[model samples]
Structures are given as C-alpha cells and as structure tokens.
Target chain A: MRHNLVLRVVAKLLIPFILLFALYVQFHGDFGPGGGFQAGVIIAAAIIFYGLIYGLDAARKAMPDRVVETMVACGVLIYAGVGLAGLFLGGNYLDYFVLDHDPAHGQHRGIFWVEVGVAVTVSGVMLKIFYMFASRGRDPE
Target chain B: MALTVIVLTRSRNLFTVVVLAGVYSFLMATALVALDAVDVAMTEASVGAGISTVLLLGALYLCKSEETKPVRKPWLPLAVSAAAGALLVFGTLGLPAFSDPAAPIHTHVVPRYLNDVLRETGVPNVVTAVLASYRGYDTLGETTVVFTAGIGVIALLRRRRKQPGAANKQDAAK
Candidate 1:
C-alpha cells in the first residue's frame, strides 16, 4: 500500500518533467550532458515507475503491449527507412548529405529522425523489461 | 571508504547489502562524472540505480531476505576481484588522459566529428549527428537489442490457456 502511494505520487510528479526534459535533451544535447539515449531511459523509467505502483495490468492498460511492440519495430523501421531514403537519393548507406539539395539540412533531418527512433526503441525496451518482471508471479493482489 | 566497506561487510541483512551496493554504484558513477566521462556516468546511473535496483528487489521478493551467516572465507574470490581491479587501474595508466587534445582518441576520427559534424550536418547537436548518421549501423544494433527484449518479455509473460474440453466441461457445469 505504501509502495502504491509512493509510486502514484512520484509518477504524477515526475512523468511530465521526464518527458519535458527528454525533449530538452533531444534538442539541446550539443550543449548539455544528455542526449536521446539518456532521455529515452528517463521516459521509460517513468513508465516503469507507474507499472511498479499500479501493477502490470494497469500499466498494460495504460500502454498496451501491442503499442509497445509496434513502437519497437517502428523505431527500427524509421531509422532504416531514413537510411534507405538516402540510398534512394543517390548516396551511400546512411549518407545524409543527399537527403536534400543542401547537405547540412539533410544532416539535420537525418539526425532528427534517428533520435526519434532511438527514443522510441529505448523507451519500448525499458517498459517491456518492466512488464516482464512485474507480471512474473500469480495474482498476488 | 574502508570503514564503510567494513560496515557493509559486517551487515548480515541482504536488503542492507543490496542498498549498500546501490550506494557504492552511485559513488562509482560520481567518480566517473568527475572524471568527465559523462556518457558512461549516465549509463551507470540509469542501469545501476534505476533498473538493477528494481530487478534486485524483485529477486529479493522470491528469496529469504535475511543474509545467512558466513560459513567460509571468500578469500579466493576476494583476491581475484582485487587482482582484476588492480589490473584495470594499471591498464588505464597506459592510456591517454581524459579530453587530452593530443590523445589519439581526441585527434582521430573524433576530431572530424567535433569540428565538422555541426557544419556539415546542420544539426546543433553533434552527438546526435554522430549517433544517428555517422554511426547509424551501431544504432541499428542497439535498436535490435530493444526489439529482442520486447519479444522476450511477451514470451515470458504470455498466459497459458485451458484445454478446449476442460473449458467446455466447466462451462456446462456452470
């Protein structure tokens, strides 16, 4: 019971800030100590906190297994698809210079998409691991 | 530090042991950050304090919490661990200093990324540029790790279904 309350209050307080900070890291990584990977873990940690407090079922209700699975696949797909796009644009694999006429712009576009992919995959993995561990016993409630 | 280690060693509670281990990890992470390895420090902080703690707690749930009294000296394992630690520190002495301008790590391909990645990639974040573009293949592997973990979770948590005849019989009785 105490765990539940702690989880609830912590989740409510931290999830929003975690998400906001993720965006900040995503955008301001060059100037700070964080990047997509760190932000992704932070977001996932928040969700995992929710799972620990509310039980696996409630957590699943909040973030369905299907959605998490799709996000995992989609992240990889998005990353590969961007590289393939560069291929179509007549460049080498992951060659962002050909993404647009302006090579610099292409690089920015490529990095943005890839970071999005990282964020998706990392968060999905964290939540999935939490779900696996949390669902391990018979109904204890 | 030695005193804390003695206290932790003397404690006979597994919960206290795990908590102390976490504190130790946090201290190690602090040292890493102070040494200017922010990326490694961040990874350690998340994996050590966040995920490992949760996993350890789960394992603790399925086990007796009390620590059994020591029956034998763990001298061999202690000696091996100490030797490994000494070897690691010794190895580092031969390596370049952190952020050294002339270090091979700083002078090689890394300089290219630091100097030109922003200008070439038009991305304000050079780390993102390197992670997403210059080293995309590595990122792909990282993503696959996540994909495998998700699948593993589903496999582990999937519920077993009752046999059709059993379910039908139960329904008829109801």
Candidate 2:
C-alpha cells in the first residue's frame, strides 16, 4: 500500500476533506441530513484510509489508543453529565428545557452537546475496534 | 439489489461475501434515500456499508478466508427461513402505505414533535431535534449502549503487555 503512489496521493488529498465533511455533518446536523453517528463513522473511515495508505503505525500515532479509549468513556460522561446538569437545574432527568435562560436556546445547547458526545464515543469506539482488530493475528512490528 | 443478494448468498469466498454484503447495504441506503429518509440513508451508507465492511474484513483476517461447505444438506434451515420470509412479506400487507399521513404513528405524538419542534428546540432538522431534545433519554441510553459495546470489545480482544519490540508502548494491545 505504501508503494502505491496513486492510492497514497488520492487518500492524502481526500482525507482532510473527509474530515471537514464529517465536521460539517456534526455541527450542522440540526439543519442537515447527517448527525453524530454518520459523522463519527466518516471520521473513522478517513483514519482507516490513512492507515491503509501509510501503515498502522502512522494511524496509531495520529490517533493514539489512549485518546481513543478516553474518548469512548468521555463521551458517555459528557452525555450523562448533561442529564445531571438538567437535574441540578431543577428540570427532569435528561431535560433540555432548563439548560439555558431561554428554553429554546437551552434546547439548542443541549442538543449540541449531546450530539457532540455521541460523535466522540462513536468515533472513539470505531477507531478502538479497528486498532484492536488490525493489531492482532499478525507479526508484531 | 436482488442480484447482489443472490450473489451474496451463492458466494463461497468470505471476502467476496463481505464485499457483496457492503454492496447490498449501499443499495439499501439508496432505497432509503428514494423513500426520503436521508438521515437513515446517511447512517446506512456510513455505518452499514462503510465501517461494517472494514470491521468485517478485519474480523475475517483472524481466520480462514474460505467458508467450508456444510457436510449435510440444510433443508430444514432453508425451509424455516423461507417460511419466515414469507411471513414477513405477508406482514407487510398490514402496514400502512409509504408516507401515509394519516397513519396511526403519524397521528400520534408525531404531531407535537413536527408542530412544536422548531419553536421549542430551535432546531430545523426534525430527526436531530427529536433524537437529541424530544427523546433525550433514548439518545442517552443509546450513547451508553455504544459505550458498553466499546468496553465489551476491549474486554474481549485486548491483549496483555509483552516485550518492548512486540508492541507500541502507547497504543499497546500486547
């Protein structure tokens, strides 16, 4: 794969845009056909493409296992924290109505954070799984 | 699409089967787009067709690439599957027409979400609004489910530490 110049160049050219598009889907989910889950998978796909083009070492460096592991736990924390915040703010569990001074604004804020949580966990889990699978059943480098 | 499925069923090489399964998923995504379920389509494209292929391929690397033929004829399993599929086709007859506005589901709490989402959530995408705000608990549960799945995979597949040259110290699976 490293010797394949065409695939290497094409993947290098396409990876950034794939990431940018994932971000667009993540942040603009409120007005678009994509959201956290789709964006997360796309993000993982870009990294996996990079891994294929260069090597597993390069991709692991780009996204370390520690970060991926942290992301997996942190996303759930962020989501649950939002619910806890709602409870603290005198709203029901997982309530977005009281997240901000204006209920509408609060809804937007809550949704934004929740979607972010979803994205993080999804991408993290994906990368972690990919890494786990790729590292096994082969010679150690 | 049916052709892809047929080929998928007939394929003996596991790699070919995995790739054909991805094609089937892509076709399903296209069908979802035609049905105006763009969000689900995007999910199907990315998760179903994209990552699923890679993951399955990775799993395939762990074992033989060729599927061994069954020793005996599986007539009972085939009959059961055919009967189940027929029941599913028959069940579809009870379902409402595509995008039927007056369907019971549409007439239920959907109206509140459709009518009040923008005003309350300030989100234009109904799916996002519903998933994130209207049904926040469900999304939280789903996120936790993803978390649990990740943990489960790590628990099952993670290897212990070995000598220096055997693994990356930072990203060490072994």
Candidate 3:
C-alpha cells in the first residue's frame, strides 16, 4: 500500500470532493432528496477511504478519538437542547413552532439545527464503529 | 439477486461473501431508486455498500478468512426461517395494493402533511420537513440511539488495551 503511488495520488485528489459532496447533501437537504443521514455516511465514507488508502493512524490524526467521542454526545445534546428550548418557549416538547416569532420560521430554524445534530451524531457513530473494528486484535505500538 | 444470494450462501470464503454482500446492497439500492425512494437508496448505498463492507472486512482481518462448516444440519433454524417467511407473506395478504389512492396510509395523515408541510416548516422538501419537524422527537431519539451505540462500542473495544502505554492512550482518548 505504501508503494502504490496511483492509489495515494488518486485518493488525495478525490477525498476533498467527496467531503464537499457530503456537505452539499447535508445543507441542500432542505430543498432536495439528500439529508443528514446520507450526508453523515458519505462523510464517514470519505474518512474511511482515507484510512484504507493512507493508514488508520493518519485518519485518527485527522480526526482525534477524543474529539469524535465528544461529538457523539454533543450532537445528541444539541438535538435535545432544541426540544427544551421549545418547551421553555411556551410550547410542548419538540414543538418547533415556538422557536421564532413566526411559526414557519421557527420550524425552519428547528429543522436546521436538528439536521445538524443528526449529521454530527451519525458521522461520529460511523467513525467509532470503524475504529473499533479496525483496531481489533492489533498490537499496540 | 436470488442467484447472488445462493452463491453467497454456498461460498465458505468470507471475503467473497462480504464482497457479494456489498454487491447485493448496491442492487438493493438500485431497486429502491427504481421505486422512487432516492433518499433511502442513498443511505443504503453509503451505509450498506460502503461502510458495512469495510467493517466486515476489518472483522475478517481479526479472524478466519474462511467460514468453518457447521456440524449440524441446522434443520430447526431452517424451519424457523421458513415459518417466519410464511408469516410475513401471509401478513402482506391484508395490505393495501401498492400506490393505491384509497390505501390507509394515503387516506390518513398523508394528506394533512402534504397540504401543510410547506406552510408549517417553510421547507420545500416535504421529506425533510416531515423527518426533522413533524417527527422531531423521533429524530431526537434516533440521535440518542446513535450516540449510545458509539459509546457502547468505545466501552467494548477501547478497554482492552492493557499495556501501560495503552493506559495513557485511553486517558488521551477520554
């Protein structure tokens, strides 16, 4: 793998585009067919591809384990926090209508934040699973 | 697809099986697109064809490349699967026809959602509006589940590095 110049060069060229596409799917979801779940998986796939071509150590450096672990929790916190905000804004739990002065705008804002939360959590979960399986039975350096 | 499944079942080589599984997933994703479920297709392609294959290959690296033949004939398991399949097929007998306008789903909350989604969420994508707004609580629960699963895997796999240096790595991971 180290001696494979073609794979290394091609992957280097392609990873950024893959990540950009994932972001497109994440943010453009409101107007199209893509969404957080698909975007998150695509993002994780980009990192996984990097790991496959470069090395798991390199991928870990690109996205530290501690940061990924926190992301997994923080995403859920963001989602639940939105729900609490709704409750405090004179609405039922998870009521997006109370997020702003206009109910429609509130719904838009709520959906945006919720989708972001979903994307982060999903990407973190995928990376965690990859790390676990990849590191299994390997001797520690 | 059925032939692929048969080949997958007969093959004892885990590598071939895993690769075939990815192929199967791609086929399934294509089928979903044909059914106009583009989002589901995207998810299946990414998670099923991409990540699942990589994870399966990683698991294979930790163990035998070939599957050992089971000693038993597995008749009980076969009978159970057959019974489950029969039950599922029987259950579908009562379901409304595909795309029927009078179907329970079409007649129920579907109309309301279709009528009000744009006004309610100010999002042109009805699917996104439904998933993130109408079903916000459900999505929150799903996010929680994803977070818990990540934590569970970390707890299961990261605790096994018993060396002193590994302990330092664990602290850093924290």
DockQ of each: 0.60, 0.87, 0.84
> What TM-score, computed on C-alpha atoms, does each candidate reach?
0.83, 0.94, 0.94
- Which ranges of candidate 2 are over 4 A from the true structure? B162-174
What is the C-alpha lDDT profile of model 1 across B99-122, one tens digit per residue?
678998776798788788767776
Q: How well is candidate 2 docked (DockQ)?
A: 0.87
Candidate 1 CAPRI grade: medium
| lDDT per residue as tens, model 2, B1-174 | 999989988989999999999999999999999989999999999989999899999999899999999999999999999999999999999999978999999999999998988898899999999998888889889989999999999999888667667556656754
- Local distance difference test scores for all models: 0.77, 0.91, 0.90
Cα lDDT, model 2, residue B142: 92
Residue pair clashes in candidate 2: none
Candidate 1 vs candidate 2, lDDT winner: 2
Q: In terms of lDDT, which candidate is strongest?
A: 2
What is candidate 3's lDDT per residue for B1-174, written digit by digit as tens? 898899998999999999999999999999999999888899999999999999999999999998998999989999999999999999999999989999988989999999988877789888888899888878888888888888888887875445899889999999
